[model samples]
Target: MVSVDYLTKPLDIFKEMCRILKPGGLAIMSFSNRCFWTKAISIWTSTGDADHVLIVGSYFHYAGGFEPPEAVDISPNPGLTDPMYIVYSRKLATA
Candidate 1:
């Protein structure tokens, strides 16, 4: 959804990711403090790194069939370099 409000919707894409994955599968999405603000989605640019993690977490939550999303700090050097985070969720196992 490349509209005036959002550059892209990760939620839409995450839904597809959930649908494609097998039960008990894992989905990982990475985000960083580095991005072209003008080219990124409004929220991505408007918010800080922490909020970005919650935003990505929401994608997994609303996408359905996934366990709680978790955030991983993978930055090599927090102060020396740009910060990075890996947000992931696992597809729920079939009952």
Candidate 2:
């Protein structure tokens, strides 16, 4: 999905993902420095890359029913343009 759609209603989408995922399944959210800025959420457009991780992590946390989210910086170049990251968590077996 596009950044605007996903970032704008992150919690709702996250909850839906959790609902459909089987127990022990993983939900992964990946993003990069690239996006359509005008269509993205204000927080998403305004924050630096590191904060983006926290913002996405917070979505997992607040949505409740998943494992604590973990963040990975899989950026090809740490300081270069288009840095990539993933914030992921698994559905709880009991969820």
Off by over 4 Å in 2: 1-6
Residue 42 in candidate 1 has what lDDT?
Answer: 78
lDDT of each candidate versus the true structure: 0.79, 0.83
lDDT of 1 by residue, 7-79 (tens): 3766778888888999989888876777766788877788888898898888889878899999988999988
The TM-score obtained by model 2 is 0.89
> What's the CA error at residue 69 for candidate 1, in Å?
0.5
Per-residue accuracy of model 2 over 27-57 as CA lDDT, tens digit each? 8888887887777788887888889889988
Q: State which candidate has the highest lDDT.
A: 2
The lDDT, on a scale of 0 to 1, for candidate 2 is: 0.83
Worst 10-residue stretch by lDDT in candidate 2?
1-10
Error of 2 at 72 (Å): 0.4
